[model samples]
Target: MSDAQRICLGAIAGAFGVKGELRLKSFTSEPEDIAAYGPLESEDGALSFEITLTGQSGKGALIARLSGVNTKEQADALRGVRLYADRGRLPALPDDEFYHADLIGLEVFDTGGAPLGRVKAVLNHGAGDLLEIHAPGMTASVLMPFTREAVPTVDLTSGRIVADPPEGLF
Candidate 1:
């Protein structure tokens, strides 16, 4: 399926044990919910797997077994493979919340309405989410905190974001 129709839920970190279990790093809010959306597809949509979560590993990663994997070699071969679920299978979000995928590519503008840039990516480095904005004639992208104060408005229907970033942030 196309990326627009699917949302990435997690990725295979590596083989977990000799019995074919895999280490999975979930991107879901509740990490374990990664497996609740039913079977997941590979990034290219060429492979599908039914995840059976076995336990949790270090750093909050999960231990899981794929439907057909039964050997360390089989699981190792799939390491680093990202897993995606159909968007329709996911629950709708409450207002004021948005999927990172939806935020990317949205135009960002300053409070005064001058164009700042387009969102290059949404990233979280533990503290909170940040919007990576890429603009013209800039040597590097600007990272703006994704907060109620920093970003006052996000109109998904209009594909725009109105940001009142801290002084000198632009």
Candidate 2:
């Protein structure tokens, strides 16, 4: 299936125990709700798994059993596999909220209407999200804080973002 047809919902952290249970890192606000998205597909959509939440690990990660996985080796093999749900199953966001998937390809512009570039990715290294812009002439991508002060406007319909970067950031 096409990536545009699905939205990432969670990931397999690795095997959680000697049994087939796997550790899950949920991308949802309500971590447990990851199971509500129905069957999840692998990043490439080459495989699908139906998850049944068993409980939580002592470290707070979610414990789950995936359909057809019955051994530690089977669960361990799924480590680092990203899970995606059909976009149709997701709820619409409020005006101020956006899915990182929707922002990936939007063009970015400065206050003066000059083009910065398109958003290559939205990264969150534990300190809020950053907009990674792949500018036309730059040797490296620029990372801009995705804060209200830095990114004042995001027009999803127009597929454009207006950024008022911190001084000298651009």
Candidate 3:
């Protein structure tokens, strides 16, 4: 799918209860707002579900009911599934901010125009975002800090990022 089509909004944690309730982890700044965009679909768009806010669970989680899910087994089958909303429904981002979807697959380069790699994934472990880049001739991808100092420039329009990696990091 094109980058302009799908924007990830949330993820399914697992089944909350026997009645097909789901433990949802919303990625929106205002978590509850995820339901405003409309029905969410899986990455492949093969599965679609209308989400309803049931209540708030512990630790920034929401209890939700999927339109067609009526059994715990059905909900369990969806654990770890990411939810995407139509990109048109999402708001525009500020200049310095970027969606994880937009960052993935962008070519990364050093300040001197040396090819580093393409961003394979964007990861956040409750600290800050990391750009996982898989460079040529490397066995594994390297995690580069997304900070301004480390990554001097990000030209989304051109699908390129200029990174100033630390000593011996590349």
Candidate 3 on 1-170: residue-level lDDT in tens?
76568999999999998999999998887889988988999988999999999998876689999899999999999999999988888999998988888999999999999999999998877788899999999999999889999998989999999999988888
Model 1 misplaced stretches (Cα beyond 4 Å): none
Model 2 scores a C-alpha lDDT of: 0.91
CA shift of 157, model 1, Å = 0.3
Which 10-residue span in candidate 1 carries the lowest summed lDDT? 1-10
N/CA/C clash count, model 1: 0
Model 3: ten consecutive residues of lowest lDDT? 1-10
Q: Per-residue lDDT for 114 in model 2?
A: 96
Candidate 3: C-alpha lDDT: 0.92
Model 2 C-alpha lDDT per residue in residues 1-170, reported as the tens digit of each score: 67777888889999988899999988876889999988999988788999999999887789999998899999999999999999899988899888889899999999899999999998877788999999999989999999999999999889999999899877
Best candidate (score: lDDT)? 1
